[model samples]
Target: MAVVAIDKKDLLAFVGKALDDGELARLVTDLGMPVEKITESEVQVDITPNRPDMFSAEGLGRAISSLAGIKTGLRNYSATDSGVSVSVERSVKKVRPYIAAAIARNVKMDDALVKSLVALQEKLHDTLGRRRRKVAIGFTDFNKLKPPFTYKAVKPDESPFIPLGQSEPWTPARILKELKQGQDYGYILEGHGQYPLICDSEGNVIALPPIITAEMVKITPSTRDVFIDVTGTSQHAVHECLKIICCALADRGAQIQSVNINYGKKTLTTPDLSPLKTMLPIRTVNKILGMDFTTEQIKEYLERMGHGVEIKEKGKLSVVSPTYRNDIFQEIDLAEDVAIAFGYNNFEPILPQFSSIGKRSPSDVRAGLIRDLMIGFGFTEVLAPYITNRATNFEKPMLGEHPAIHIKNPLTENFTMFRSWCIPSLLEILAASKDQKMPQKIFEVGHAAILVDGKPVEQEKLAAAICDPKTSFNEMRSIVEGVAYELGLKLEFAGLDSHPTFIPGRAVEIIMDGKPIGVFGEIHPQVLNNFGIEQPVTAFELKLA
Candidate 1:
């Protein structure tokens, strides 16, 4: 969360009328602003990350008007096909695939607009596009640039251009050093042999993706119209960047122009905007919130959100959402919008319409009993993160043949895989406590991952481990059976099973209700050595059913 101080005078001007104290408070709350205090002159607002569009006063004002029904029509940005052109070359296809551009004409450039543009670009770069590695945007003064701009990849030493904030023309590699944006932000593509650069047909460099642009065409207050370019490796990402930039420019009252790019045999256009139809079920709205509103009330709420609701023969409302609302893909989303428009505070907080008592499941009850039993047996409970390293999750000997869910975009390697079992994590805790004296008894009651029919299924289980010089497999099994008996759970012991991470003759599987729930084993000397554990260890697990 970030707190941005919106000028009170500026906000009032955009708000269009003086708001009373309660009305202002409702306006702030309706716009989802966490207003700490409201004074006679200014207001302090807290903004959330998801609503980057609300960072600007224009966006916030528009949202307030839409909710208040002051504005009931959809706003569209008209694309002006008059100025600027960008051409993609074949050389950059393998390095960066897609590019999109729009021309913003007659933009009233000022200090506030410039600061807002720069801040919006940086925020979008970091949040939506991962700091422009996935997508990058470039803004150039249209008056200075020649027609038909070329976006291509060339030799680092062969091209030279004056980067933004620099006084002299430098080669691609040298520009990385002079601009100071290359080493810090350019490192994303530094390992590649060739860099992604954009230039005009006359070999004049424009920009390096995820880095700075040339100063020759920098946007200034004197500039009236500008050319905006977005480049990325993914076509979908490039289109999203275009939408973000197009919307931001439209806020400044810019007339957008769709640019055509030649990609081998295919020709693509910028800002390929489309309108989508979202259906809202009249019955669903009534059921979810227990609202007694008729279909007419629902239709009015939809209209308030800049949507045209048409009642079909089936009695469902067909709400047409503007193309800018790419997030509304489901009926629940439409219901949420209706709720917002209806006013969250207006809804009465009452008991459930249908009387149904909440109760714990059988598995939950058994798991709780096991946890309490373990605590009574002089065992301390420990809870570890559900995400763990691959080395501890899969490389350990006592591990089972279960697939772990991997994070696609993990921030660190340690959180790569979801934990399949709690036993391996317990071993890590034991290793960390090696310096302490003997008689270490620990227990964990948590969820574990298991693969059933090729899909992951999470199950609740309880595990206990005792580390001492004299700990044995039978001792751990006795504790498990005792806990199961106290919970009125029947347990069956299977034959010794061979596991990669466990001693061959010392391991047995625990079965409950004809389902194999857990395993009990003594720490193998070789496995103990692998974990740097010198003392004997015993562990057991039981699934709560």
Candidate 2:
């Protein structure tokens, strides 16, 4: 979460209706903004990363004001045309293409406004810009730069130039090191064999994006106006950051100068905020909110939320969303507004309209049976993390497709991969317990992930492992067969010629009703050696259904 300081005057202007301390606290809590402290002049609200729009005091103020009925409108402030030109060279398209810039003119800079601008830039860079890789922002002393800037890629070892906050000039690579952003974030371009660089027409370095900016044009309190430039590999993200900065500055009463960007034959305006419309069936609103409001009532509610609602038919509503509200793409989202406006507490809490009671599925029943059988067999039931380390997941050399979900933004390498099978997890437990006893029997009934037809699906699975030196393939198979027999299931085996994680000749696939349900095999000597386990091991896994 990003903590933003709100000026008392600005806060009051945005949240028009005065709120008592308790009411203000409740509103902050409801909006997920934690009020760190309040003074006679200003209140500091902690804004979350996902809510980039709230990074500025104006945005937060507007949100609270609207909710409090102090304001009944939402509009993107119209931008003034500055006629600044930014040209995208063809050579940079494959490296880093997109660029957007906006000039904030006639703004009086003070400590409060300067700090707010800097804070907003850092927040957007970390959150929406994805730490500057997908989007990076550069603020220039508008008085220092010449108009019609150029954004393009340059050599990694390009000429040494001073970076923002640095006194000495350093090469691109050296600049990365001196700025402390090289080894950490400099690698984003290492794989591409090029680095994204920003410089003035005279070859003075302005920024080495995603790394550091030149110290020459850093924003300061003396700077009355600022030139903000965002460059990135992702056009959409770059444009979004542009809008974020533009809106935040507009809140401070700075006039926005739109810059025309040339991308081949197409020309686009920076900070573009065009209106978008989406239609929804009125019944959806009624069903979700349990409300019976007329179409006019719903329209009024949406309009109050900065949405332009039109009656499409007797039971359909068309919603025109301001360009900044990119989160509202679905009809149900508008329905939510209807619910909020209708008063969530006003709806009668009736029993489910349907008479039938919710019950577990047959698969759930089978899973319970498997759980009981495992416990009855003296096997201590264990549960493992659904997400597993990539090394454990793929290094095991398990046969069949790797099963596990992969996180897009993994906090660490240890949790990067999802578990496709339970065998590796059991093997991990066995490795840890080697010092405890000779024989360790454990069973786990949980979900395993797999990709089916390009979509991820999870299936309930049962896995059991015994780590006794005497454990063999037949012994594990008997336990597997016994569990199936107890569940009124017939099990048959087909020879498995080769399996990576199991002894090639000792593994067999378990078949039930002509469908392959599971596998039982002796742990391959190579697999055991990898985990530093000396005892012979056998493991089996069966699908719950």
Candidate 3:
């Protein structure tokens, strides 16, 4: 979700009328964008990630107008051919293959307009752009560039140009080293043999895709005509980004124009503003909303939600989803849109005909016993998120080649993969508490999603860590032995070796019922250093029975 704050006057002007704070919030909430706060001068909204179109004031206003019946059905925008062609060279295909181009002509720019463009670009970059990995965007002064742009690759050391916000010309490699952007975004281009570059006819670089743009071609308050380019690993994502930006620019009185994408083997023009068509069953919509609406009434609601609908003979509707709305991927998505348009607050809730008592599952009961047992031993329980990155789950744990459930479209690198174990999470907590206190004993009886035959299997496990200057493997070993004793079970210990996560011979494997169950050991100095922890630590983990 993205939080957006817009000027009250600007929002009213875009909405084409004055709306009270409550009224605007209510209507926008119906659009799935809820109001976080509203004041005399500003309105802050929480926009869902699915509707990137609502990230800007122009997009939100357009949707509001259409849903309010001020304007209904699919609002179409046609892109005129700009005659600007961007040639795609084969050299950069191995790097960033797909490129889509659009020209926003007759753009009227002001301080607010400029800020809005930058905001939309950045918000899209964070979400649709996938942190500029799956997609990246670049915009420059259209009139300043000569026609016939070339997208190609070059040696990082050989290519030199003035990066955005800088006066000095630096090599691509040097920019990654010396500039702040390069330091932050250089990972996208660091290991590749050749880096991606976009150049105009006169050999002037417009901007480096996925990185900084050239200073000479950057957009400013005086810039009227704008050239937008989106390059990515996926062709579909590139086209979606172009569609979103073009729609926003069109709302600002700019003429949308198409640019030819010369992909060598095949050629295509970008900014495909055509709506995607899909079929929605009337019965399905009614079932989900729990309300029966006439086909004509349903069509009216769909139109108000900015979808073109055609009634079919059999309880089916042909829906044309607007190009700006990317969330409509299935019939269920249309059902959600219909519910929103029908007004959720107006729905009547049905009381349950049957009542029953609810109780925790068996796993929860076992977890409760383990948590209480650990707490009785003076260990504090802390909760951690299920998702984490590779550095903490793998590199820090020294468990290479371990696979976890990874997200396809991650918002940030911080929580990009699921955890298969709970011990690493415990260590991360200890590392962050270095300044607070010593002897920080903590434990977690949490769920871990382990991959089973390519599917995730969720299970509850217990892990505990005791950190202090005098921490040793013996301390953790005794804790495990005492727990087993309380459970009235016999356990055996065996030397654990060959694991890089702990010291060579200091680690031990716990065996119960002639089966290897768990392990505990003094934390390796190298592992502690990797986590920035100076104190010694000992930890143990096992599945909850």
TM-score of each: 0.74, 0.77, 0.90
Q: Write the per-residue lDDT of candidate 3 for residues 1-545, one digit (tens) a residue.
A: 88887776766677777788888888898888878998998878888888888888788887887778877898787799988899999899899999999999889898667777788888888887878888998899988898899999998887799998989898888888889888888898878988889999999888788888899888887888999999988788789888999998898899999999998879999999989899888988888877798888889889989898898667889999989887788988888888888888878999766899999998877678777888998899999998988888889988885667997766666888888888889889988999977789999988787787888887677789999998788888889988788767688888986667788898888788888767788878898888888898899887665
Which parts of model 3 are misplaced by more than 4 Å?
81-83, 90-95, 130-134, 165-168, 220-222, 233-236, 262-268, 293-297, 353-357, 487-492, 510-517
How far off is residue 475 in model 2, in Å? 9.6
> Who wins the lDDT comparison?
3
Off by over 4 Å in 2: 1-10, 30-50, 89-97, 309-318, 374-458, 463-542
The model with the greatest TM-score is: 3
Residue 525, candidate 1: alpha-carbon lDDT: 74
Which 10-residue window of candidate 2 scores lowest in summed lDDT?
396-405
Candidate 1 residue runs with Cα over 4 Å from true position:
1-5, 20-22, 36-50, 82-96, 153-160, 169-180, 233-237, 310-314, 353-358, 373-444, 448-454, 461-545
* Cα error, candidate 2, residue 437 (Å): 13
Better of 1 and 2 by lDDT: 2
Error of 2 at 324 (Å): 2.1
> Which digits, one per residue and each the tens of the lDDT, describe model 2 over residues 174-205?
76554577767776566655667766677776
Candidate 3 minimal-lDDT segment of 10 residues:
401-410
Model 1 alpha-carbon miss at residue 269, Å: 2.0
What lDDT, from 0 to 1, does candidate 3 have? Answer: 0.85
Go through the candidates in order and give the clash count of each: 6, 7, 0
